[model samples]
Target: MSATRSAPVFAINHMVTPALRPQAFFQLARSLGLQDVEIRNDLAGNAIVDGTPAADIRAQAAETGVKIATINALQRFNEWTPEREKEAIELADYARDAGAAALVLVPVNDGTGRQDGERQNNLRKALTALLPVLNERGLKGFVEPLGFEICSLRSKREAVEAIEAIGGQDTFRIVHDTFHHHLAGEPELFPQWTGLVHISGVTDVAVSIGDMRDSHRVLVNAQDRLGNIAQIRKLLAEGYTGLFSFEPFAEEVHQLENPAAALSQSIVLIKSQLQA
Candidate 1:
């Protein structure tokens, strides 16, 4: 892929305030000259449901030229019971109509401290059940294996295994997150699974992976990149041809005096780093 061929898509999760209206979010992306945005469903006031009429989202996309790269998440879909399964299917349909290219699925962080075998088995079952729904919708299911110590699936290896077990490699792909990859203590794991990348940086290692919340994520730079550039280089070298989205979750970014300028600067910085 050319340096700009796989132009990075950015997520509004780091820039838009949850309280802001969707129109304002798209406008922000437009001002940044961004053509893609990832929408997180659980953000307060941003709970996008099936009831959220499609016309509104479609209009925003049309006006801004910002396409929905992926719906933020369908959490623990791997462990959903029959009732939850229906709810997820409804959300998948909503995402399709909203013009989203994929649904990002984060594995369940079941707090009960189950044994490793049991957790893996539940994950396989969940992915198996969710695959057909995704296939029917023609939507890619981007599985994001979070790396917090408590998270059930912490690496791409496990995600690949789960997808393979469920025969979902055709419809499902991995979401390689820089922050999560660093937290997972696996710096060079991207080559095995080529898919979407969620990029961000963290500064503090003293902060335990479990204790470090999303607020700590920031843009990549020498002072605080936490090896994100190295990670991206590895992915590019490995022939990844998918989107790389900035998904910082920091309140500082959202509260910036000029978010568009910040986003533009961040994108430039990312481009420079990738080219370097």
Candidate 2:
């Protein structure tokens, strides 16, 4: 591997510290030596969902000098509806004002939108609807296909095709989530088309891959069964130099008394694996 392709750049998502205030999350990112971070709107009672002013988020991020990579996502993004359009517009505006680099677009994972002939139409409609909104705000739309069987969009291949079909390669990019990718059993990596990579690991020896859920996610380590290191190595070796945002969803990670130390240890382990 080339020296330039050695270790990936690291980032953290608000999910890692779902309980922290937005300002504190920014401070945490800076203190961890991570230059980039992602925020979320789903955290109950949090700033975004609670309607904290976007100006506040922007100011806090500026003070900490940590770039807000994205808002965790616009859930069920592909199921276009008047409500979803309104939601997208609201998020796009926030993303613009908050200085967020992109707006993550997560597909419908409710197990209801995958019916015959509905999936493709929903995806195309969502992309077409979102292209202009993101373009207007000068924000990239990071479309993430969940790996779950019920997820309407399960493959990056399909996401990329939809993006291309809509001539949205410039306005939209795929989020190659390591955990989701493994879950979906994807055989190919769209390294060049990927704009972000969410990293998490599953270390439970007894948990089967099919039974894995976000709650099972935790920081990467020697016991990780998700092949995070290997997947990262594939992306880096293919010249995908983008943010690797930590997104462990397990309660253990969220409840950690010193998440910073635990995060640093995971980062060290991942980096060492890449260099090796």
Candidate 3:
């Protein structure tokens, strides 16, 4: 249980404050003494989704000394279609322009896409189509499989297999999301194939995994029932030398008036646990 000097790198996602503007978000990362950060394309009023200029985002990163670890996603990425292709092209363009290192790829979670053995076929097709988009942008695709029962892609093993099937191993990687992993109840950890790890904790003792939702997500602490510290320990032990980005989606977290202070506290808590 001893902490190593090589504790996983910490990063924060904009979901920590979905309402925070670009520069303000970057400054919050800095205030927490974090150099790595992830931006989102899903926040309704925010720049990336709201059509804010990429140069403006790049400038904000430069000014704040915070590196853009990733853009939080191209949603439902596994269910490829003409519209999905267009969305991928546009989002990849933005990621490239913004100097973000990678794009998070979230598969469809609506409980319908992966039925009757069509799941693997859909996954391979998506990866095949996405390979060139990411390669052309010199960006990495982080395929994140959700753990929900209805999610099209639930297993990291399945994601890795599909990535290999499409020869996307060189340009794509898996996002080892802690919350999803707990829900998936998988026993293995694939550190080598992981590009990023999204960390969040759920403390609602009354909720079952089947009923858990993003609104239940919150920063990891002693109250965490999801085993964040142990899961992180397993990843690091498995040779995962990537960014551990905080990605709490609770509305209460997003509504925090002093997000910097809150994040700083969470950072200290995780660090202390890692060292224990």
Candidate 4:
């Protein structure tokens, strides 16, 4: 596909540099001329998981001139329960105090609760329950539909429908992940409702799409099998004006001796392709 549009802005996810401190990660983003980033709750010895105060996170972002686009996720969010509600409230409060604009809502991916009507009902229930918490904190809920076969929410269409059912159009938006979009086999871009776009590539030619896992995710390049460029171009052309956060989960990315340099190369590759 020939894309004549200007390159989209890129953001760095903490997954791309899990070993770095939040301060260091923010600096790396700034060094790359990027102003946005996504912090995660899963990284051990990291900010959120390490008990770092929200004020400190806010201070760090201010010091480095970086915006905390979101707190990477609240897991298994589709299963509505008192425990999940508590977690959502706490995470939302933390995100607001930490100056993050949103929280990512990830669904259960363990193969349970995925029955057709059951999944939609659970999604709507969760969104209904979480709406007030997010609204009170003035934050957006970025619902990210995981593409795994076992994932409770695999299709963006289902996610969007659930969001609409809950009347959450104002407080929620979907995450259009290139990797997940390919795996879900969904054709619609839904750019109007996409608040964020995650860009990752799968370059392993031998791995079947059904067998692809997070360990196989890598940065976009010539070897990308997920059509990151085409998806990005389509989203951009169709009115998705949001950050494309890099979320490579492969150990190779984490083990890089110079992650900033490696990430810069990937950014260059993506930009070249988008502006081609």
Candidate 5:
């Protein structure tokens, strides 16, 4: 077997809409020396061409030489009924044809009065219903546990349990988000089940973890990066061989003069810290 590399591969979501085109996105990643990218389908104007012909996305990826590592998300999948489930299946097909390796699934946050047992049962049902579609399409489902109080799954531990219960680990994996991990008060080594890790920093003056919000998320080197370095180091030490994608959703980062430069700098900082 080949020796494992310590340097983490990096990618960025299409968050800086007006500033970066798909071509420019690839060029920037190439300049920064990255080989993979995760495209966010919700970014205004620069949304990954999902509903359009897959050939368009294929051409862009081919022209840019950047493989589509994963598609940003298929939200609220856990609560999806048959109609919604069918739609998600179609989306999975689209992702595969677009040359994506996986689809990220975010649990539903619908404020229902279901008990904890009901919630877990719903999650299990959803996974059982969707796993066949994902497996058939040769696509992996990256289940991301959101940390917001209202969000259903708040940690990779919960996601792992659900995956184990649903028996989808063969076709589903976890996505560890630094921002979510901090907000959820989850440990860094929780990345053991991770297939993809999202890197973002959180800044808040609150004394406790519950006070942090997703809006506080910024680039990796921001002030609230308490365990960013150590967490990534631990993941590396544990033999994680996946891409670390930048997923800052803050308005400030979206308005930056050169988002790619900021991302490049963040990658360099992460590399230096990890090497040390």
Candidate 6:
């Protein structure tokens, strides 16, 4: 957008259209002129959960020429246990076999395991256990801290500290989601440690910040109240060269008759703002 800087690269997330199949999702990414995408395992009847083979997903990526950025996510990852370990192994193996470069690790968000010293220890424990699994598969773990009040992990600083304490500086990185970043009211930016950026905007004037949820997350536009453009500018200025994947969770966006056109407009608006 600047005379000296190129525009940030944008990627599509499967959440944009959970109705589409994996192959169609890849096709959608290619149609958007994006080669990178974040796929989800939570979608009903989808991969990883529905038993879709990793080889099939890899073939889809190759055919559509879309790079699988990550599998979103291994839920409650910080509450490490034997069950979590098993799930982690399966997901990490799926990520590796699917040609994805990273796995998203979402911490417990159910208002439990968040005590002062307890949360840090739990975080370190999970990281310590996951380091080897990720290392074995040669995959990066993108630790995403949710911004909800009930979330066990709400601070990127804490996640970073845990990562450093466990000596996982290289094995793990953070996901700087614009929505979560704003919700958490975090002012710090770790551009160097960021591996992915999820972008979504909440424009409803009636909803208070505390009341905002994933259902309110919509595509970024001029009416966005999330300061998405400002966040992007800062990240870019600070040398964050990761993909900005659209991750709108609003049902309105998912129901759009032409999401590709809507996403294209959003991209244009973001680019124009950066240029300005």
Alpha-carbon runs more than 4 Å astray in model 6: 1-5
Tens-digit lDDT string for candidate 1 (160-203): 88889878878888888888887778655655465688877777
lDDT of each: 0.74, 0.91, 0.89, 0.93, 0.76, 0.94
Candidate 3, residues 93-211, lDDT tens digits: the string is 99999999999999998887777579999999989999999999999999998889988899999999888887888999999889999999988888888899999999999999988
1-276: candidate 5 lDDT, tens digit per residue: 323558887877666333576777777777777778877666655645435566677678888889988887887888868787877877787788888899998887655624688778877888888898899889999988877777777757767888999878799889888777767777645545788988888665664576666567788884655578877887777778888888877788878887768877787788887877
Report the Cα lDDT for residue 90, model 4. 90
Model 1 TM: 0.88
What tens-digit string does per-residue lDDT give for candidate 6 at 187-275? 99888888999999999999999999999999999999999999999998988888999999999999999999999999999999999
Writing each residue's lDDT as its tens digit, candidate 4 over 24-64 gives 99999999999999999999988899999999999999999
State candidate 2's TM-score.
Answer: 0.97
Q: Which stretches of candidate 5 lie over 4 Å from their true place?
A: 1-4, 16-19, 49-51, 188-190, 204-208
What does the lDDT come to for candidate 4?
Answer: 0.93
User: lDDT score, residue 90, model 3?
Assistant: 94
Candidate 2: 10-residue stretch with minimal lDDT: 1-10
TM for every model, in the order presented, reads 0.88, 0.97, 0.96, 0.97, 0.91, 0.97
Backbone clashes counted, model 2: 0
What's the number of clashes in each of the models? 1, 0, 1, 0, 0, 0
**Model 6 — which ten-residue stretch has the worst lDDT?**
1-10
lDDT of 2 at 14: 95
lDDT of 5 at 144: 88
Q: Model 2: clashing residue pairs?
A: none
Model 6 TM-score, 2 decimals? 0.97
